[model samples]
Target: MVTAAADPTPQTADAQPWGRVDDDGTVSVREGDDWRVVGQFPDGPPEEALAYYERKYSDLASEVTLLEVRHRRGGASAADLRSAAKAVSAKINGASAVGDLASLDARVAALTETLSAETETEAAAAREAVDEAVKVRTELVEKAEALAARDPRTVQWKQASAELSTLFNEWQSQQQNGPRLPKSTAQQLWKRFRDARATVDKHRREFYAELDEAHKEVRDRKTRLVEKAEALAPKGEEGIAAYRELLDQWKTAGRAGKKADDALWARFKAAGDALYGARSERETADAEASREKIAAKRELLEEAKAVPDERDLAKARALLTGIQRRWDEVGRIFPREAERGLDDDLRKIEQSLRTREDADWKRNDPEQKARANDMTRQLTEAIEKLEDELAAAEKSGDKASIAKASEALEARRGWLRALGG
Candidate 1:
């Protein structure tokens, strides 16, 4: 029996088989025993070539299986064999597989191209939408600016213009940035905008008509008042008072159109000036006469003041009463001379009597001095309070408050005057 060599060389195997090609284009095989060649072939077919390799390596399957097992068990690495197997598989199936892969890649490329084209189309549509919105916004902004420039004093026109302007702004802003609505919504919005504008225009026309009617009424009323004033102008004090009343009524009347207001005011002022001018002339003549009478009374007052000191107090009082009656009978003096005339007369008489009274009081009692001092202090406080009230009234800028304060000041002054200080 022969033992397998320690090296297991193929040269020392039981048979050494070699392959050759036959004349028929088929492969033939020969065997070598103990390393001696036996046969050759004329031609070798691919299958015969494969068969020759198979027979010589009859235990190839088991060797491959053992190798895979060893690789699995981690006894040896099968990386190179696995790579070779994959390469063989790729070569066998590569042609058929490439057609499907190429078709899938083409489909993916087509999908990418389609998506890019759609994106571009969408972008262009968005740009168009934005441009349209901008146009609407610009138009609305111009309209609103024009409306805002209108005069606010024209109440109805201004209000209508403002409302239209606001609506336009709202509509434009909504179109630009608000939700996208359907055609019906757009139609409804447009209709609303049109109807609102129409309504405003109609209302404005109506307002102007009413304003015209009102102006006519004002003109008629003012014309009647002017006629009444002209009729009453010749009557003396009665005419003056009546004309003043009419002036007051005119002031209370509401405003008319600019031309009518100016015309009416001019007419009213002219008529009033003519009437008052005549009355003023008459008053001046009367005042001059009254001044002459006041001068005579002032001479009489001087005479009364010159009355010699006497024990007959009753006769002195009677003469003073007569002088006061004469002063009263003299009536009003000219405003400029009145104050001086009264003050000079009263001061002379008061100084004379005050001297006599002081002498008399000194002869009688010290209690009278105390009473006068108390009265003086009370009057002074009252006057101070009155001045404060007047100052406060002026600060408030109220006619009614100032009037009330004036009355209080007068009352306080009356008290002071009665104190004979």
Candidate 2:
């Protein structure tokens, strides 16, 4: 096969350099130091015979390039790439190709080393992500567990329930989108979360159950209150005080459910409305019936007004006494408001007359008369002394002394006259 050193030139399609054609059309490919028979191409030319096998070598080189591309792009798993690289290496080692087969094997080997490092790094990252995900999921579970551990009575049920629901939604989202944790850890965390949720659910049910019972009791109480309030409605305006008492009771009555309370209150308030309505109607009737009495009282108030203006104490007393007698005769006014106003007006007039009468009585007292006489005597003596001083000042032509004496005498005389001296 080493005839004159077999063609060691680079293979080409036309030269068929990696192969030769025998006279009998037997083709042989150059393999190391020997020529190995490949196939017979009795009907084709030498170039065609070698070109057919050259196409095979091209196909093999293409496979190696594709594998390298896949490895570079991370399009296949590391293990899958390794397996593929081995297969391609085997194909290239003794491949029917006439191109650089050794170089292709070297490229596959480099790809295997690269894939090993990449696989290790990716595995570490994936493990870290899983651990972090477990930590986050564990935190969520702990939060839910803490919520479940809260005192049921103190927990604001509405807010707690909303938070629990939000936690559940977050758990589902993490499960679907976050890194997958180990099966055992995942199942354990899920069980804990589910139990916490179940505990919250149970507490919620129990809390609402107690509230419903309390609400039912309140409803029954309000229902009875409503019946009692309605019973008072038949008594008309006379029952207004009783209805007011029932109203106080209604205020003290605890709450039922919203719908029930609203409905029951409507009925109870209607009963109260009936009582108030009766009172309003009665007031209207009384106001109409009291029209003449109001007029009579107004006339009396006008007559009594003179009592405060009376100059004669005895006459004012006589007039007030007559007015009081007639005021009683005028009878009661209705709606009471107008009655109170008119009575107040008349009483003020009477009080004025009484005050004047009291003054008069004080003036007529024997002790008062004695005191006045004594005062008049003292003033008379003081005036006599002042007159003497004025005369002396006039005789002496002392003008300042005369003026001062005159003023003092005049003041003393005025006091004496005021005492009815």
lDDT of each: 0.60, 0.82
Candidate 1 residue-wise lDDT, 1-421, digit = tens = 1111111223323433233334443433332222212223235544444354334333333333443454446532233434433443343222211012222233334434444555566667766775676456445545544444444446568666676867676886777775464566467556655664565566667778888998898888888888888788567556878888998888877777899899878888887788778868877887867768777766876768645454565566667668777777766666656757676766677567667766776646768777877888987898898789888989989789889889988887888787676
Candidate RMSDs in order: 24.7, 8.2
Look at candidate 1 and give me any clashing residue pairs. Answer: 21-41, 21-42, 21-43, 21-44, 22-43
lDDT of 2 by residue, 366-413 (tens): 999899988988998898899899999999999999999999899889
Model 1: ten consecutive residues of lowest lDDT: 1-10
Give model 1's clash tally.
5
Each candidate's TM vs. the true structure? 0.43, 0.65
